[model samples]
Structure formats: C-alpha cells, structure tokens
Target: MDEQRKKGLEKMNEVYGWEMPNIEGDPYFDLTVDHLFGSIWTRPGLSMRDKRLLTLAAVTAQGRQDLGEVQVNAALFNEEFTEEELKEVAIFLTQYVGFPLGSGLNGTVSKVVAKRRKAAEKGAGEDKRANVNAAVKMNTGTSLDDE
Candidate 1:
C-alpha cells in the first residue's frame, strides 16, 4: 500500500477496532482514505464516535444505505454507540430526516448488530471448547505445553 493509504488504513483500523475491507484493490479507496479519512477523519476536534454518528446521520439522510452499512458496522464494532443510543439518534433524526429513511437506517443497524452478535456467540463457543480441553488436560495430569 502507498504511505498515505497505509496511514489512513491504520488510523481507520485504530478508530474502528477492525480491519477495513478491500482498501487495497478499491480504486476510490485512496480518495476516501487520503482525503476523507486522512484529512477529515483524523482531525482531533471530533472523536471517532462522534464522527461515526455524524456520518451515520448524513449517509442515512441521503438514503445511501450501502455506504451506511460500513459506518453502522464500524460504530457497533468500535463500541462507540450502544444499540439503544443509535435508536435514540434514529428517533430524533426521523423528526427531521423522515420516517422511511429512518426505517431503512434501523434495518441496516439491526443487520449489523445481528451479525456482530452471531460472531460473538461463535467466538464464545470456541473459547468454551478451549477451556474444556484445558480442564480435561489438567484433570489427566498434563499441562497443554507438557506434550
């Protein structure tokens, strides 16, 4: 990756708590990262959570649900806003933004939340299995590292 894009991706990952998607091959990724993220998103004035929320409202207002998905998922993964807080934002925004747009945003948020919850459950199951294996090993008198 180019230095600017790399820096932008790094900063985005730091803020979003997950790796950004397809930035390497995306043609417009540079514009978004270099201009949008590098210049605007990296600003110190607004916290990332605030930025995410603002972006959420702006994108949702424009009916850009496709783009909104990334912002929505990132907001959840970053733990910047609770689902309830997002719902409240939806309520207030709908007063100005219209019900259809708000409803679309709500659907997008629900999908992202469900996806994250499923992933968490899967990870928890894997952790449970690991702990059980460890316990069995301990009961049989050998540490996992011993063999």
Candidate 2:
C-alpha cells in the first residue's frame, strides 16, 4: 500500500473501531481510504472526538440511522462518550433537529448501548476494551459509508 492508503486504513480502523482490510481496485473504497480518511480525517485541526460528534449529528439530522449506529458504536467502543453522554446527545439534538429525527437518534443510542452491554455480558471473561474490534463488528457490522 502507498503511504496515504496505509495511513487512511489505519485511521479508518481507529475511527470506526474495526479491523478493515485494504481492498484495492475499487474506486469508491480507494477514494474513501486515501482521500476522505487519509487526507481529511488526519488533518490536525479537530480532535477525533469532536469530529465524531459532528458526524453523528450530521448523520442523525439526515435520518441515516445506519450510519448513526456506526458512529455511536465507535464512540462507545473508543470510550469517547459515555452512555449517559450519548443519551444526552440524543436529547440535545432533538430540539434543533426536530422530534422525529431526534427520536430516531435516541433510539439508535439505546440500541447501540444495549448491544454493547449484551456483548460485554457474553464475553464476561474477556476484557471488553481489549476486544474493541470484535465488539464493534458484532454491533455495527461492516459498511463502506462509514463517514
């Protein structure tokens, strides 16, 4: 892999809490990994937590629960946001984004929390923080539209 692509893949994995493989040849994946993640995400102005909040809000406002779920799961897995904080985000967003969209986000938050809890329970013997990738994959699934 080229330097940018390698960097993108690592950033993508860190952001999403997944172990995404490098899939060459597809223009969409290539651009996503090389440009969006490599060039944009790695920029120094914003912290990862800040970027995640913006992304979560944007996706929630657009009624993209699938994407929102991914963000929520990542945030939780990475410990960027506590469960209570995520619940608060849903409530805070509901006011500006309207009840329907906010309600959807609230629901997404609940689902992600429950899934994480369940996974933690299932792997009671394992260290949840150490198995971030497995928990994230089980909860969010793999997707190309991560951003």
Candidate 3:
C-alpha cells in the first residue's frame, strides 16, 4: 500500500478502535482513506475527541441516527466520551437542533451505552475490542462497499 493509504488506514483504525482494511480500486473508499481520513482527520489542530463532537453534532442535525450510532460507539470504545457525557451531548444538542433530532441522538446514545454495559456484564474477561468491533459492524454494516 502507498504511504498515504497506509497512514490513513492506521489513523482510521485508531479513530474507530478497530482494524479497517484497505478497499483498493473503490473511488469512494480511496477518497475516504486517502483524503478524508488521511489528510483531514490526521490534521494536528483538532483532537479526535473534538472532531467527534463536531461529527456527532453534524450527523444529529441531519437526523442521521444510523450514523450517530457509529460515532457514539467509536467514541465510547475509544474512551473519548463517557456514557454520561454522551447523554449530556444529546441533551445539549436537543436545544439547538430541536427535540426530534435530539431525541434520536439520545436514543442512539442510550442504545450504545446499554449494549456496552450488557457486553461488559456478560463477559467481564472478554476482549473489549471484540465487543466494540461487533457494535461498529452492526451499526455500519459489513463494509463501505455494502452501502
């Protein structure tokens, strides 16, 4: 793999807390890995947590609960935001984005939190990465190609 793609995959894996394979020959995936993630997300100024908050707000404003779930799962898995903090984010965004959109986000946050709690309780010794990968896959589908 090229250096930029390799760097992007590494960054993407770090951000999502999972191993993401490179999807060669797909323009969308190429742009995502080589540009969006490689260039934009790797930029120095904003922390991943800060970028996540911005992403959550943007997706929530669009009422994209499906996307919100992915973000919430990754954020929680990465320990960038606590469950309580996510709840607060839902409440905070509700004011500016309106009740419906906010409620959608709230629901997504609650669902992810509950799932993580269940996983933890179910297998105290289980690998946390497995649970997170499962959650991310469930929310995002098998791959970008599937979308």
Number of the top candidate by lDDT?
A: 3
Model 1 Cα lDDT, one tens digit per residue, 11-48: 85665555454234334555666776667788888888
User: lDDT of each prediction vs. the true structure?
Assistant: 0.68, 0.81, 0.83
In candidate 2, stretches whose alpha carbon ends up further than 4 angstroms from where it belongs are: 124-147
Sort order, TM-score high to low: 3, 2, 1
Each prediction's TM-score versus the true structure:
0.72, 0.84, 0.85
lDDT of 2 at 146: 50
Tell me the tens digit of each residue's lDDT in model 3 across 1-147: 999999998998888777776666667677778897899999999999999999999999999897798889889888999999999999999999999999999999999888878878887633545544554354344534344
Estimate candidate 1's RMSD in Å: 12.7
Better of 1 and 3 by lDDT: 3
Q: Candidate 1: where are CA atoms >4 Å away?
A: 1-3, 21-27, 124-147
Candidate 3 runs further than 4 Å off:
124-147
| lDDT, candidate 2, 2-116, per-residue tens | 8999999899889987677776566777877899889999999999999999999999999988788888988987899998998899999999999999999999999888887
Number of the candidate with higher TM-score, 1 or 3: 3
